[model samples]
Target: MILSIGCSEPLTTREKGAVYGTLGGAGLGAIIGSATGNAGAGAGIGAAVGLLGGALIGDQMQQRQNQDAAVQRQLSTQQAEIERQQRELEQLRRQQAR
Candidate 1:
């Protein structure tokens, strides 16, 4: 019996962070606002602030990850080229030795 599993893409770190931040902020705000007799207003304000902060942090992290990946790819390509050149040099040396 063979089984195939399909996987769906997960949310990016930025999206996840933003969602968490918004929820957390709203909850906190509501609690604080309730103490002041205005829970709804507190939650709204908290959610907005949380969402903005979370999104910014997430975006920065994502950008950094992308840059790191790019650098890794470049390093890998350079290594491959170096290997190829070494092989070619060895081949040339062998020919000259003969």
Candidate 2:
């Protein structure tokens, strides 16, 4: 049985961006296409363009997020090492005082 915990974002940034772009493009396209008596065509073209643009933007964002995560992981490891060294130093100080 698979249970989903609400620990993750429902959609990836790229997917979210794509969805938004598609909706916005379709709306705008429909408006313009209606004026030109070719709403369907306009919407199709708009959706395609929007999808491409959104995907690119989302991919960049994802890359940035990945980089940030890597940095965070590195920082965490460093912090743990520092903590361990501090504990070891405390132990040494106790021995020296005895």
Estimate every model's Cα lDDT from 0 to 1: 0.86, 0.82
Off by over 4 Å in 1: 1-8
In candidate 2, stretches whose alpha carbon ends up further than 4 angstroms from where it belongs are 1-9
Best by TM-score: 2
* Worst-scoring 10-residue span by lDDT in model 1: 1-10
For residues 2-75, could you state the per-residue lDDT of candidate 1 as single tens digits?
11123256667787668777888999999999999999999999999989888888889899999999999999
TM of each candidate vs. truth: 0.79, 0.84
TM-score of 1: 0.79
Residue range with the least summed lDDT across 10 consecutive positions in model 2: 1-10
Instruction: Please give the distance, in angstroms, between residue 30's alpha carbon in candidate 2 and its true position after superposition.
Output: 1.2
